[model samples]
Target: MSTNTPAPVGSSGKGASLARMGVFTLAMINVSAIVSLRGLPAEATYGLSSAFYYIFAAIFFLIPVSLVAAELTTGWPQKGGVFRWVGEAFGTRLGFLAIWLQWIESTIWFPTVLTFAAVSLAFIGPDQRWDEAVSANKWYVLAIVLAVYWSATLLNFKGMRTSAGITKWGTMIGTVIPGALLIVFGLIYWGSGNKVDINMAPGNFFPDLTNFNNIVLAASIFLFYAGMEMSAVHVKDVKNPGRNYPMAILIASLITVGIFVLGTLAIGYIIPEAQINLVQSLLIAFDKFFTIFHITWLGPVMAVCLACGVLAQVVAWVGGPSKGLLQVGYAGYLPRAMQKTNKKGVQTGILFIQGGIVTILSVMFVIMPSVQSAYQIISQLTIILYLIMYMLMFAAGIALRHKEPNVPRTFRIPGGKHFGMWLVAGVGLLGSVIAFLFSFVPPDQISVGSPTLYVVILLLGAVIFAGIPFLIYAMKKPSWKNTDSANEFEPFNWELKKTNTETSAPAPEQQH
Candidate 1:
């Protein structure tokens, strides 16, 4: 059976032992990697019905991703995460596409998220009008987005130890503590016979599924669950990955789902449906929730915590995919120049490239009609790119079950092997395809510029970004491989088999 012998180039030493992460630490990393509070207010528009959408998405997308990823990571805990998994199933060609999509989607998404973070920063003041005006200023938004993103990238460059430390505390203070507090305050408000805006009647618990626009909004919840697989890249750094990693995924999924579901309900309980503006409603809800407890002073404090949570989440993202690309770089997929790593084994080169992409995309704030327009347009592309990657991941999961049946796995999908793999990965793949389709239909609420132009941009972005990896693969040369001491990678099952099919010869010399 094949084994995932941990590599030395993980965090700080020449041994995997250097970066020993416990279940709690790994779980926190997973949590911070995916959760963001920006979309809760949008979901709050559905009132108590939002819970139905959250639970639906968790079943079809979130849980499937967690299960498939657990099986894939435990069976093949290589450095490249999705790159390694897909490559094993198909070939290096598509695998590079998978990893690049992971990188580029996050690249495209930086602005949307940082814009939210910028708004969070804007709210760190007493006056709502001032906060609204500051958030709308192009210059203020651009500066905050660049500054915060670059700071997170730089923090990740310090390697896993420093990054993980900040992630743990940041997620706790920013997300978990604040989320718990909001839910608690919401309950208090409801208990005190406060005027709740949403009807708690059982009949209002489900959204109108016949409405296409509602599905468009609900489909976005899929992307909220997107980054779980990225955390698989860190399995090697964890303690007893076979045992602890799967458990961590379950723990993180629960925390994230709870925050998203209950947090949205908190907002719905406080704010009237007619007044819910996606941009300001969350802060507005927080303010009213604070007022209920007679602690309106804590409004700005909550804003700061939300910003910290975003920064922590960005740090998690900044590390995972870039490191995965670095692994593929050593295998000759990326240019040798981009394969460099620091003393702490962080991929500084790729981070710079990633930062450069963000810098360019951030310029759209000034180029577009407004920051909101830029975010609305660019975010569609982000969803498209990421759903494509997810589709590939789900396909790879099912393929690997048959293609490498003998490979030892610490965790497998429930039920039997083949049937379980088909069921879980099939559900994930179907969900991704559905989300990908729903992404094109522009929401009825927002004036996303010209709808035709918006759809054109999304289609064109998908084609262009998806094609770049293929171009890279075609242009690759043996000389592109990094020969440095830390660049060693294991041969895939398919690569080994192809080698044996050729002339009977000694194995290819280990390429580092």
Candidate 2:
């Protein structure tokens, strides 16, 4: 969270110490927080080239985000995670946009993720045809998405301990175990005499760079590596903040990339590229693998695990951004209503409003032709907004290096102070720019119904969603400050400087 705490994700307190924490535990937490089977099928469509995208995204985007965010977190160390980081570099308004994009992207992300859970739930039965048909039904998907999302949202009202349990168990059972099984099953199938579906030639390792639509879909692969920024705060938890921190991050990166690359290859090896259905292909691949091994009952069990994982992920994410938004609201960016919390200090008003937005966006399932297409459309929009936020975050990192060079960061990006910042943040910014531009182009891989409507959804969603924050920032009143005595959000450094300069200024006669 922009608030710079893990409690929003899993922990109920600030963080733990090296006595109870180690490199491996931190690495696995990064793995479980980030690794998801829902996205394997999308990358699998690229066959051997999927490995390239995953590695590329990790180097240019994933590692840089964690590194840059770590620097920003230490430098600013303010309550508003992104809001504090960006506002310190730019101003409160752009800072507001940064946090808004994060919150909105996550809100839009729920239904798409839950769509996978819906499909997982639908495919829990042994009959493939019936399961596929049911998963494709928009109404069924919608009902499951709403029901499950609402359940997670409601559970959030109970506070962090409840969701933490769901996230912990869900990540292991749903993601880790299933991901291992997928790779093992693929190796087993390959070890036996089973035929491979995708081309294994070295030439197939690189995608057609000229194909704009191909890159458009591949742009989404950047997001698959998202959410590792949480690891940055753990730098202090390990023995050597310098050595062990980067090592843990590197190990986690390798593990995360390994799971993604191997898992994607596993799916592509079995399912023909043409037969890949974003919503159903993962479940189908599992069932196919089980059928080959003559143990078909595990298909439903895998679905249950995957569905639970997605649901648990929803529970984990439900309140994080909203809480950041809530903190910002307390600082006077949002209405009093949105700033309200329940007895548990949960951001109920914002959560309820987020749920409403999700309910509306979930309708895209019906408006688009198929579940995959709808998923693709919404996903494209999510990437665009998120990439914009990333671009701002990256640029903010660079800007602050120049603007506040003496701020005494606990961790630096490594190289020279300024040059290293440039190298890392620049790469992240460039990658984000490329992906941001490509997100507007509709992918040829999925049927998005109307290209015009698809573009409209992307353009309008980006413009309107990004535009809303400035409107709220402009509308904020001085009286909007946090009413709570204990949790008064800190003012931005610029805000304090402006006050100081004003205080030191002379009267008109005195100045003359």
Candidate 3:
């Protein structure tokens, strides 16, 4: 039986430790990585039916991704996350595409989340209208987004310890505490005999699936769960990965889903369906709850927390996918200039390039017809790019099952061999494809201007971003690899097999 040995956690010999992370720490990392409370109000617009979307997405996308990623991570506990896994199944070219999508999607995603953070910061003011004015000011939002994102990028340049510390504390202060408080206040509102705005009728639990446009916003829920697979990259860092990894995933998934469901319901219970604002409702709900509970001062406090949470999230992601792509670059897929690292061993070249893309995307606030339109366009594009990568990942999981069946997996997905792999990865792929298709059908909730223009931009963005990696792969030169780099990304298993086959074959008639 063949087994891929796990690499040391802090393998870079720069005083990094090999200490393993505990299950709780790993679970919190997953929660911090996955949960974002800002999007709850948008989902809350569906009333009680929002529960159905949350649960449906969790089943079809969340659990399957977590489990499948756990198996893949444990099977090959290397540096590159999706890039390493997918490349092993397909080849280096497509593998580079997978990591590229991961990095670039997050690059596009920064502006959207930062927009939420900008709105959150605006709400810190006492006057609602003034806050709304600030939030709506495109230049104001653009300036704050660039400032916060660049700050996070600079902090990340220091190294992982600094980045991870911010992510941990930021999650607790910004996400977990605020989420729990929202749920608590929701319970108080219901228990205090207050009239709930949402329909609690059992019949309303399921969403209207007949109207495709009605469910378009629900498609965004898939993006809410996007970063869970990212946490899987750390599976090998946890002690007893085979046993503890699943435990961590289970705990994290339950916590993540609970926060999402109850948080959305909390907003639905307070804000009327028609009045829910995609960016403002979350804060407004907090304000309303605080007012009723006679703790109105907490509103601004929660706003600060949410803004910090957004920064922490950006901090965590700013370092993650880029680091993976850096590994891909070292594997000869990217030009050597892109592979340069700082003295801190951080990917300086890639970080700067990523920041440049972010700056350009942030500028869309001025060019797009409205701030909301810009938000929707970039958000939809992010969803499409990420879903494309996910499709490749799901397909890779199943392909690896056939190609490397004998490779021992410490945390195999439950069920018979082929059935387990197929069932888990298949559901994830189907959900991703469905979400990808619906993302093109402009959301009914927002004013995205021209529907034709929206579709064209999404298609064009998807093709262009997805095509760039292939272009780089075709243009790759042997000199693009940095031999001086201490960390050497492993060759794909197929490449090794082909090499072994050729080496063992009889020499060409010796040309004697």
Candidate 4:
């Protein structure tokens, strides 16, 4: 056999050195770009106040989840990521289910987010009746929806490099840039003697936790922040997993909070709560702002950016979750058909299945009387699925501490083992349960189906969809396990010790 020259050895501990990352970049990527969209007309539709209630709602639920996710991700960096972590914590079945929920939710989520982009695209002018076109001929929206879905699907076929490029630029240009401009536009209007009558009086500013609607709204917001660990899968790929992970979360969190607060304030300044259209609300704000300011020219430009952002968001969603699901598939949780991968390592089969499911869900636009109704209906299923995943993930966080007590972790929750892990896990558990309970109550405003129909759909969704994994688990056997891939990721504790030796960090006890 012809032998290539032996590669030179890297410096002592040089391989481990490659694992460090700065906090800011990690935070920027982990922080959400989509939070502002939910805060605008969406929160108003749920009857939340702009100030006290909405932000309080987020702090109690969203913020904690982000922190918890950051801690777990840094602690456990694996190829399967969440699946591996949860599997080690719980069992193979529950882990499969966790990844399943994450994967399925994204597919269901496609139609809803795409509709947001389509509505924003309609903002070009009074002349372009995109929304009217969608309503008048359902197939028009269906076609565009399919176009977006397939385009996103094919983009991923080139592998994650294409997806990453989209996510990075899409987030900056599509999310941050547009969000900042909206705030600036609102501030300028306020400076020009245009007063927006916002109901920020004490009572209105605080969200009524006692109110069923507001409580459910908070639950919904909790799910909106559910994907904090979505980027956790990338930890191993980063230059330095441990340091970069937490930093990235922190950076992303700051960006997310700024956008939510400022963007909502902008919307409130431009349009009153009652007049906000849950369906086409962003446009309403832009329309009103443009009309008063006479910068009508920027309307379409913003719409284009928003549309491109939505497209990027869709691509991100499409690639991320399906890749996780593909992991689940390789674990024998899914049929071998789904395990097919191309030379470049893209999972073409799963992408097709995801596209099909999205298409089926998209047909809801035709059946539901209003597009907003379709959004609400499809969204309920997504929330329910997400809550189930949160429950498993939270429980896994606690279980991992006990089951793999000696596992090497870059960061562990601060409190003593008995208290810290339980406390953090408890918060996630409680929030998830509360979200699950409230998901059944149809929103007071949007009506996709009757209250009875909502309850039936909720039960049907929880039982049928959640049951899919059990069937797969029942079919599992020793042969189902792939011997080659069975080797779990083991942190190089010796190398870790040498690296931390300079800092005098204590050696961690090795787990079996």
lDDT of each: 0.79, 0.84, 0.83, 0.66
Q: For candidate 2, which ten residues in a row score worst on lDDT?
A: 1-10
> Per-residue lDDT for 271-317 in model 3, tens only?
99988878678888998999898988888888999898888878867
> How would you encode candidate 2's per-residue C-alpha lDDT over 476-507 as one tens digit per residue?
88787877778788887778888999999986
Record all residue pairs in model 3 with backbone atoms less than 3 Å apart, i.e. clashing: none
Task: Judging by TM-score against the true structure, name the best candidate.
Answer: 2
lDDT, candidate 2, equals 0.84
Measured against the true structure, the TM-scores of the candidates, in listed sequence, are: 0.87, 0.95, 0.92, 0.83
**What is candidate 2's TM-score against the reference?**
0.95
Instruction: Please give, for residues 276-394, the per-residue lDDT of candidate 4 as tens digits.
Output: 65657776677667767787777778777777777877776777678767766765667777767788888888898889989988998888777777777777788888788878878
The candidate, 1 or 2, that scores higher on TM-score is: 2
Q: How accurate is candidate 4 locally (lDDT)?
A: 0.66
What ranges in model 2 sit over 4 Å off? 1-16, 504-512
* Candidate 3 CA-lDDT value: 0.83
